[model samples]
Target: MVPAPGPRTGARPRRRAGGRGRGRLADGHAAVLQERPCWGSLEDDALFALFRKTEPKVQEIAPGHDPLGDLGPRGQCRIQGLDDDRVQWQVEFAVHQLDGLRGQDDGRWPNEFLSPAMVPLGGGLNGMVSENRAWVALPPSCLGRPGEFDGPTVVDASVGNKDVELGGERGERDRTALARAVVRVANGTLRQLGCKDSLADPGKLPPVSRTTPTQMDALCGIKGLKAPDAERESLRRTRVTSGQGGPVRTCDLTHSGRPWSTSVRFMTVEDPQLAKIFSMAAMTGGPRIKGTKGYGTLTPSRAVYERTCRTGRAVFLVEQRQSDRGYTLPRELLPAYAESEAGRLGCGPVEMKMPAGS
Candidate 1:
């Protein structure tokens, strides 16, 4: 009874010019094309084809909502309109990385998608924060049994003083390894999602995008540093220290075969999660913090001073590299992700706490 579906065109079906269904002309008589029933035996086919075409367009335009009625009309958009090829490629790459498809032979489409999306996705803050926390909490199962860090080792120093050593060959190696691991996980995850052009040789990928100094200041939650006022003056005095009794010191240390003058310090915190987050943030953002020949030599000057002054315990022999640019996890978000084993572990409103006495 019903006619066969309309001829299958290679191109998907699209919406009618005016709106749903064909339009009639202004004349008293229906348009010539009106005889061609908009709802015909092939109507279902046409509608399906139209859906195929329009859905993608909708997704491209708005990525926060469903294109089809199946997902319901949330009034939000669900498409991403990626115009720039570079950005498109980067998004693909980052997507591939997140999909866990690194080192796979299935091309690199996932990686390409993810690479560009990083910028628009809050400068990879979401991913970076998530991954760093994961590393601190879970580490890698392949790392083998945990060894007891009694003392005289970098890990030991890190655990004991809650400080990190970011100098020498070992430090560079550890950082490179961690970075590579992150990249691998990101790429590998994306590969599983059918991205073909994501991975194109590590050397070819763009250099790790650097966050602007302004962005860093924003993340630090410091307001009006550039403004002139008594608060600003007080901040200036608090941040700077002079010859004999300055709060910060620039000391030379070798990192990744290069010498760097890094500022080091110690921060006392009660929460272990906060401590882990601070360590991971510093290692990933500030500088490499492992594989150093003299890692054991690092120490926290303030902690030692405090212990000596308060408890009269002469524990000042340990010297470690601590940085001024460390963070403490916000107390508020702790409850939200406390139950999550591997995702979204509570971190919010991170505070830049001063080391002992700023």
Candidate 2:
């Protein structure tokens, strides 16, 4: 992006967001590319303008999280509670070429919920193995709310790149074909989710997740899911009872015949069974078991219990997008589905990794 011999000829090329190459807005030329932040409570455009006008007290290159694979620039903006306070937006830009048009847009998105509660999302633009010349932009975060991304879901978005080649009709047809193909892919994918008000002001939650489902993703009747034979983990059984002694065990698999350190200790009780205990139990407390760190209900969640009780044919649901031991879960659980009852839940059911009948 060197200036062609003039007063601004010494202009240095700025490194693009992806570090793929370089770019520079020509001296004295106003930028026509448009982009806005989506994850915060305030309007990003105006906030960003005010942000740059004021200097940030803390401005440093934030390092990426190696354990989580989230390298800093996630487009999460934190605007301080002051008038002159700036917003730190973890924004990433996508740079590409299209005929005479070039712009930049990346999807480091925002959320209605905090981390851990926020459904995970991600994608990549691998130039090496893409197999197609047309590069499509995918959002880096889920557009749905806290519980929205829990079920099978689909994700899609696109934007213009920032490098417009002025060369004469070079690869115009090829580029045109690529653009059309990208549009087709986007249309096909979105259409599968039925009609949605994508252009409407998506405020805090998504325009799509307008309705929440009743049958949420919850833990089902306890079933054994085993690890790989190579792991050599053995199954064990022990007697357990509720506070006042209700048969909390579902056969030998009240929790799992095959051991699994689940985030929470879960058991599905029939409404009839729960109804009896309903009269005997206290106003606001579940059975408590005292033990070491490996105690009962490793991670207790009342929300998980409510969802489980509401559904039939017990399914061990994982509200999170993915499991810690990926190999223990099924591949179908990772995909995005349209907004069905299961889809709206944002997460999928966990298929016990153990033998089918075990």
**Candidate with best lDDT:** 2
lDDT of each: 0.20, 0.21
Off by over 4 Å in 1: 1-165, 200-227, 232-358
lDDT per residue as tens, model 2, 317-349: 112222333332221221111112222233233
Alpha-carbon deviation at 148 in model 2, angstroms: 22
